[model samples]
Target chain A: MDIFSFVNFFLLPGVVQGSIYALGAIGITLIYAIMRYGHFAHGDLATFGAFTALFVAGLLGLSPYAALPVAVVVAALLAIAIDWLFYAHLRRMPKIITTIASFGVALMLRSVVQIIWGVDTTSYTRGISRPENWFGIRVKPHELVTLLVVIGLVIALHLFLTRNKWGKAMRAMSDNPDLALLSGIDNNKVIAMTWVIAGGLCAASGFFLGLNTELRSLMGWNILLPTFAAAILGGVGRIEGAIVGGLVVGVTEELSVLVIPSEYKMLSSFAILLVVLLLRPTGLFRGKIL
Target chain B: MDWLSFTIYPVYLMIFMCIYGCLAIGLNIQWGYAGLFNAGLAGFFAVGAYTSAILTTSEAAGRLGGFDLPFPFGLAGAMIVSGLIAWPVGKICLRFRSDYLAIVTIGVAEAIRLVAKTEDWLTNSARGITGVPRPLGDLPYAQAQLAYLAIVGLILIVVYLLIERQAHAPWGRMMRAIRDNERAAVAMGKNVPVRRLEAFMLGSALMGLAGGLYVHLARTITPDAIDPMLVTFLVWIMVILGGSGNNRGVLLGAVIVWIIWSASEIVTDQLPAEFALKAKYGRMFLIGLLLQIVLRFRPEGLLPEKLRRAPLSEGALSPTGHGARIQAPHKEI
Candidate 1:
């Protein structure tokens, strides 16, 4: 294939896909850092968020982009509510119990989505838009929008984490929960804040994925393994690491079709995950081992 | 319903119950005794099912079968192959915490499912492998089912007795010690990793056995049969609800949960077609909710593990010791 075709078909799509995985991985890494458990419901929660955005867009007769904020807010609240109802009491027990509970929550969320939307694939728009040629490469409008939004979200999150007091509190909690508690950081407030940020980002990721591809009940679940691969690759608790990890996983998956059967594209991410776990359990950014 | 038909359904349910009983007990060994969170139970189960199907089936043009082996050999091959797969997985993942094991195992299971779906030469791809022989399968429907049930029941009983013996043995006590306190077990000179690997492989072998039993009963094998929800999560709930560490408790859990699961389908079928389709997901929602309620209210399950207590010296009863005894095992994962 020509370089232009490679750039358009492989590189651009990989970057876009990577950006989406980065969004999801950020949420996962943050949850792992703060709560210290793998949030199995995360992918399904993203599915719920994407569907929520679709619902809002249809109900309000607005553009999907305009409905994004509503979805983010709703998903954030849903995250907090789930934490309260299902996970709050389990806080004192073993973290594995919470993980198992989250698996149940995953099933619940997916079922709820299926009950509401049925199983057919749906899209925000009816017709496809051709990618505009820029220099020697081609990029679609939505793909550009996805990249820009991801950059904006990451920069804003960086500022929030570095500058804001509550954000510092979250960092403190993640760094050392007992110490943070001793320092008079309201543990519950920091946790709720983490959920808000994680949930909102999860929605944005899901929305972008749905915008680029078609939305289905299984879409989030399908991407979950790759998103996780990205999170662990970047290191479990590192934001910047997650971004780089996402991009790497995404580009590799897109490129792997050249060598392996397209049917086995997902295996690329799984391989990356296993390799990373074997070589560097702490991830690329030296995140916590746990 | 005719008496024969009525009798057959219950027998069929019982047979399935036995299969699930095998799975639950296997999971109990890993999760209850060793505290290893194996989210890829379906992978092992699928491996066993596919191995047995391939071994026993007659010649097929495209796939790797034609062994035409007997039922016993198929079952044995299933267990051996499944255990072999678990070896590397346990070796790598057992060093990590329970959550990491959970995610990694989930990945492995998904990978296995993908392979089963895509590899045509091995699994016959989406069409799946069919025409596998069943023991006494040539008999009339009811008689065949009863015979299969008797065979499975005998197997289940044998498995139960063997595992019960192991559970009461010193091996079981060491496993509990490691689960309850890893450092203590290590300090006491126990080979934690090796012991864990043993439990993992043994449990996986039984899961393979369950898969073999399922394939023989269905007389076919399909990738869809390895559903994460049906094979993996259902068994998880069974083990948890039945009381993880206790073998009999998990069997009870299997019987109860399987009845509810199968019966719920009948109830849902009574609804309008559109509503019936949705009710399937609704039932899943209820099952998920049931888990949360159980975890919240009775994390110890209906039948809690009974710890063996040492006899107290005469007039040497200590209230603090008694209180510690009550609180000790409750901390288990």
Candidate 2:
């Protein structure tokens, strides 16, 4: 493909989609690190967030981007409530039980979305968005917004993880919960904060995804494997690694159409995931596996 | 409901219960004995269904599978193909914790679904394969249903006996040992990975058989026939609730869960047109929530595994102590 066509068709769109995946991966990584189990409900939780945004946007007659904050709060609260109600009792149980419960939560969440919003695919805006020519590469307003929001969120998270006390405590917990507890960190607060951050990022991921394409009850469920792949590929616990992994997965998925049929793009992520697990389960950044 | 119709309803339901009973038993071998979580039961199920459908069905224009093979051959092909698919997935993930196995299985299931949807030449795309030959399909309606139920019941009995034998044998003991204490099993010179892989493959094969039976009964196969969460999670709940390690319990669980599931469908289907779709999802929400309640209140299930006395050794009881967690969290992914 020519440079302009490659950029327009693959690179640009890949990065935009990658940003959304990165946001979701960050949540997965956080949950994996702190909770010690995969949250199978995460994708549906994202669907919940996006549809929550859709609801707010419809009521207010505002752009979907304008409803991001309210949606994030709603999703965050829901995450916390889920953790408190369902997971807290199973803290002493086997990790697999919690994971299974998360699967249950996923189903519940998806059903809620389907019931509230119905199953039809809906978009933030009705009109077809015409991409603007920018140095021969096509760009859309929402794409630009997605990029800006991702960059902004990443920078803010970076600062929080480094400079904020709770963020540092979360890092400490991720490293070794027992040691962190011995060192006088409030494990409950750190757990709550982790959910907050993960939930917020999940909302952003779902919103940006809806902004880029369209929102369906299963939009998050479809991309879930890729998000998990990105998290695993980047190393399970590394923030920067998730972003890099997400972009690589995204770009490769888009670029794969050059050689293989476009329909098989989803298969590529699974291949990448298996290859990574075989070669380096620790991920590219040497993060913790669990 | 009339008494005769009600009697037939349960008979019809029994066929499904037997089919899903096979799936639950297969999972019991994997999770209950082996401690390997195979989350993509539906994927293996789909592989079996499609393979059997393609193998036994008469040919049509613009699609594959005109072999018109015998029913037994198609069923065996279903098992083999499903096991073949599980082999690679097991090889990759079995070396790790059950968590990785679970995630990879989900990935495999999703990829399989995508292929079933997009590969027109292979699966006939969304149209699906038709004319799958049933063993007693040529009979009158009630007779066919009764005959099919008999066939499925016989298969379930045979499978149950075979699996129950394995579960009580030295092999089953070794599997439980490996699951309870991997380190001890490894130190005892047990090939942990290989044994786990065998269980995984065996379970997948049974699931495939169930799928084959399902397709044959329906006389059709479609991408939409399988719902990953609905089938897989429901089976998981069945095994867990039925008593994971007990064959009889697994069968009982399958019957109970399937009844609740199908009966709920009947109820939801009766709702007004506008509320029908919402009620459908509402039922899903209830099933999902039911899993949580079961896990929380009754982790041992209705019929807990009958504990058997093991020949004691000092090596078996180590620092981990007795009653080791069912699935120890593996630090290394």
Candidate 3:
């Protein structure tokens, strides 16, 4: 392939992959902003959402596209339930408590999946290969589907965040929980809503990711680092930053095949993360802080 | 392979848990007492295991051209390797906020595991190093295991007592100050970085020691054998459940958790095939549920790290233990 084709090929996958990663990273950044401490369980949460979508689609005999909307709904509900179960009472606890609790929640979720589905990895859609031919690239139908969904979600999210009352409320709470609460934001209601939005986005990201590749109960946990790196690199607590950082990391990792072995794909992400963390503590584009 | 045979193994495993208890207690000193998280405990453990594997079982001088060094020297080398790694990680990672630091440490852990897994030059590829003989393996089987257990148990006891004593000493006080409030300690002229580094190195070295003990029992080592989730998370649970800073509670925590872990693996094999899967997950679910509930109900932990108090007459505990009150006010970074 010529340089144009190679770069385009690279950018296409990078952008598509980055968008899903960005979606997941946004949830992490938002959680970090309000909850404090890393949410180790997030990758699994995405996996759970995707697995839920896979199950619902199989049960209802719906196509991948049709199953996606229902999956989003289920994921939102699940997020709300998880938050209520684990994070609701944790508001009063110290920071580390929530971090540890998230780990617990993560482990429990993965174990439930393992017990129910068996350790063997499963996928949302089966057999017939996703045909290549989108934008002169060898991208598949599922890849295109993932890309379109991500772009739509990102745009919708940006508008909701900028123009909506609840968006401002969410931003305020992230900025300063105490100030937001004092300014008449219902901490409980806002937090529940945060979970809903994050949950929806997480489901969409998970489904799209599953579309691109096969889904395993553990896939989400595996890719969590790049997602977090993107979020942190983009500047924690900023949705745009997550999007940008995700693309950067995805591209860097995929492109690293030039020098490093393919099996060491994760190392590139780790390298980006370590370099980002060491050089820029608050991220390259740190957003407004309290 | 008779599944029932594993039942006889728990008593021996319980003794192993005691070794883990010692490591967790050391971790509690760093994370619980000093608020410095080391997610790379598995890496340190692997380092120790590989150290001994290369030393004790060198019939095949493969990669790194095996020295076949004595076991004692191998253990020392493991401690030194861990301490050396800890110093640099502690320096770079310690500067970030706790959240950032934790994530980075996790990344570092995976990196270390990956290196061992992929680089045959270091750990002899995925085939792993084998034929490791325990210390006194030439003795009778039961007697040798018991001897190994006894010798390791003694080391754990000494390490435990030392940690307990040091936790009350002046240096321990400085660590607590940094944990509770970094700026205040810095203002009081505590070499904050050095002190944190010291705590990290000590904790990591102990973790390496636990790894060494583990290899001696199993008599073989594989890079893939290290489970970051099972090994590191269990340690985190142990320290958190025991109360981050309390040595006594950590031992209890390890014993309780590991007993449950081993018992689950042993007992599940006897179950009817239908219920086997659930039995396997039952253990994982319990740990996760326990961690969440404990954090919610007792945020300080099962036994919160209680500060060693002085007379209230002297105002809040301060530098110089005598009447010197020094609270360094902060200038934000």
- After superposition on all C-alphas, the RMSD of every candidate to the true structure, in Å, is 2.5, 2.3, 4.2
Candidate 3 has a DockQ of 0.43
Q: What is the lDDT, from 0 to 100, of the residue A288 in candidate 1?
A: 79
Candidate 3 per-residue C-alpha lDDT over B1-333 given as tens digits, one digit per residue, 9 for 90 to 100: 454345436548865886688679758867866777676688888877777677666667566635767677767777777777778778877776666656777777778888788888777878877777677878866666667777788888888889889988998888878876688898999998788888888888888788777887788788778777778888888877766777887787888788778877878879998788787777888888888776666545565656556558563554543222111111112
lDDT of 1 by residue, A1-290 (tens): 89999999999999999999999999999999999888988888999999999999999999999999999999999999999999999887777888899989988999999999999999988898888889978999999999999999999999999999998998998898889999999999999999999989998988999999989998888888899889999998899989999999999999999999998898899889888888898899998777
Instruction: Check candidate 1 and list the clashing pairs.
Output: none
User: Could you tally the backbone clashes for each prediction?
Assistant: 0, 0, 0
Q: What is candidate 2's lDDT per residue for A173-258, written digit by digit as tens?
A: 99999999999999989888988999989988999899898999999888888898999999988888899999988888888888
Number of the candidate with higher TM-score, 1 or 3: 1
Task: Give chain B TM-scores in order.
Answer: 0.93, 0.92, 0.87
Off by over 4 Å in 1: B309-333
On the 0 to 100 scale, the lDDT of residue A226 in model 3 is 87
Off by over 4 Å in 3: A128-130, A288-290, B1-11, B59-61, B310-333
User: Rank order by lDDT, top first?
Assistant: 1, 2, 3
The candidate 2 chain A region of ten consecutive residues with least summed lDDT is: A88-97
**Tens-digit per-residue lDDT, B36-63, candidate 1:** 8888899988988999999999999999
Q: List the lowest-lDDT window of 10 residues for candidate 3 chain B.
A: B324-333
